[model samples]
Target: MTTLLQIDSSITGPNSVSRTLTTAIVEKLREANPGLRVIHHDLAAAAPAHVTPANFPSAHPISAAAGDAPEFAAGRAASDAILDEFLGADIVVIGAPMYNFSIPSQLKAWIDRILVPGKTFSYGAEGLKGLAAGKRVIIAVTRGNFYGPGQPTASFEHVETYLRSVFAFVGIPNPEVIIAEGVQLGPDARQTALDKALQQTAGLNAA
Candidate 1:
């Protein structure tokens, strides 16, 4: 059976536009593939601690930080689990909202969990070689203002580009992105952008 992992990183709970769009896409995916196994992870509700000295250990035993002795091991274990989940999945759907012209800390944490050395990728004689293959990813992004690459507000697009670039590092090329921008501009613009993004989701699901 096809396994799909759905992740939501928006702090706005269900009210987030990116979350709403991702939900719609997931619903469509479920309807289209009833045999699919779906796993939902909400990062906003369960924040992951950033990597630190203890979390980033060498091949040998290392000293632990106060109150972080257990956390260091737990963090590595969690990252391994996430990496396994990604390796087992056929598709992944992520909801992301722009924060300071980049991805949210929660999603970044998830990325750190999945992008591992000698697993998802490895060093090659030339540079790097991604081990992961035959997987697909869809990202739904929401922003307060309009932003598209080469547009006036393009700076806001850094998050989407960053995700695509990083995912590609693990051989997940051509990640689909649905953007809902100009939400905070006004009511009309918000509805319009959301509708457009929803339509894109519909097309993605139909495909």
Candidate 2:
């Protein structure tokens, strides 16, 4: 059976457009694949600790000073679990909302745990190579204002661009992205954008 990892980073609860899209996308996937195993991680409810000197890569080694701290040891264990989840999943669905022109800090913290050096990517004499390939990634994005291609403030759109770059660096280059922009413009615009985004989710491939 295929395992799916569903991650929600929205702090807005029911009001988050990204969260709504992700739910619909997951539902569609479930309809297509019977007995699909899903592991849901809500970053807003239980945010991962930010990367710090105490729990950095060096801390994982017993000889490192930071490794002496009990807190650091526990942090390392948690990070390992997060990485394992990503590696075990065949499909990953992320709800990414734009917060001040970028993704939520909670989401960023979760990302820091998975982008491990030798686990997700590696460097060789030839060049940098991504190890975590073959997994399907789909991101649901929401922005208050329009920041799509050719938009006036497109340069400020960091959520989608950053996510794409991160996933590509980890070996999945062409992740499917569903976006709902201009959500805060007004009632009509918000509904219109949401409806369009929901429609896009219906077309996602189950395989």
Candidate 3:
């Protein structure tokens, strides 16, 4: 059976555009592929703690000292759990809203926990070889202003770009980005953008 990991990191709960769109995508996917197992991760309310100086050393497991510090041990354990989740997933869908031109802190924390060296990815003869192979990723991004076309808003789209690049570096490439841009640009624009995104999302085939 296909397994999907749905992650929503919006603070606005059910009202968030990204969350709604991601949910829509998941629903459509379920309809297309029956008997699919879905796991939801609401990161906004249940955010993983940021890796601090105390736990930072554990990020590099090989470089850490003989014994793990209390905080470092906690961080390692947390990361291990997340990595297990990632390894088990066949597909990952993320609902990410742009905050200060970047993804929310919760999403970043999740990424930090999952992207472990010698685990998710590793240095290869050519460069990096990601361990999580053949997994598909879908990202639903919501923006307050018009962030496409020739505008300064486009430059501020670090959230989507960063997610794509980082995940691609770890071997998940060509992720489908269904964006609801100009959401806060009044009702008309919001509806238009959302309608367009929905159309695009509906056309997406499972990878």
Candidate 4:
């Protein structure tokens, strides 16, 4: 059975294009494979605390007596749980919307948790080696305006680029990114972008 971990971080609720597209992607994927199991997480409602120095993990395990506060300990546990979920998933689908040219705070918090040193990546003689390889990542992104190559606001966009770099650092160098751009242009443009994204989702193959 294939397991799909779908994460939605959009705070815009039903009006979020990324969220809708992510659901569509999952449904289309299920069409290709009937036994696909999905684990859905809404980060906006259940986001973990941000990574702070107090809650940071050490290369070696730290005991509770090592000066960690109760809140910090709980935060650490939450981070560990997020990392475990990512490690267990075979496929990851993310609904990421651009907020002020970057990703949402909730998604960033999740990234901080899963990007653990020894689990997701490690430094070796080869410089850097990623442990989480062979997992497929699909990102559904919604941007307010156009930011493709040679566009005026291309330099201002960081959501997709940041995610690509993060996933590549963890061994998924090339992820399938479906984008709905110019969503703030107008109703027609928003619908067009969404339609195009749906087409991409429908064309996805079973992993």
Please list the C-alpha lDDT of all candidates, in the order they appear. Answer: 0.81, 0.89, 0.83, 0.87
- Name the best candidate (by TM-score): 2
> Model 4: which ten-residue window has the lowest total lDDT?
56-65
**Across residues 36-84, which tens digit of lDDT does each residue of candidate 2 receive?**
9999999999999887756554323332655457766767777778888
Q: Clashing residue pairs, candidate 4?
A: none
Better of 2 and 3 by lDDT: 2
Better candidate by TM-score, 3 or 4:
4
lDDT of 1 by residue, 1-207 (tens): 989999999998867898899889888898888888899899899876775556542221222233346646765666567767888989899998998889899888778767767768888897988778678899998888878867787854778889998889988878899989989898999999999999999888443
Each prediction's total of clashing residue pairs, residues at least 3 apart in sequence or on different chains, is: 0, 0, 0, 0
**TM-scores, each model vs. reference:** 0.89, 0.94, 0.90, 0.93
For TM-score, candidate 2 versus 3, the one ahead is: 2
Question: What is candidate 4's CA lDDT for residue 55?
Answer: 57
- Global Cα lDDT for candidate 3: 0.83
Reference-based TM-score, model 4: 0.93
lDDT of 4 by residue, 1-207 (tens): 788999999999999999999999899888888999899999999987776765555332442335666656666766677788898999999999999999999999889877777888998988888889999999999998999889998999999999999999999999999999999999999999999999998888765
Candidate 3 lDDT tens digits, 7-104: 99999986688988998999989988988999998999888888654444344564264456564576667666777788799989999898888999
Best by lDDT: 2
> RMSD, each candidate, Å?
3.2, 2.0, 2.2, 2.2
Worst 10 residues of 2 by lDDT: 58-67
Ranking by TM-score: 2, 4, 3, 1
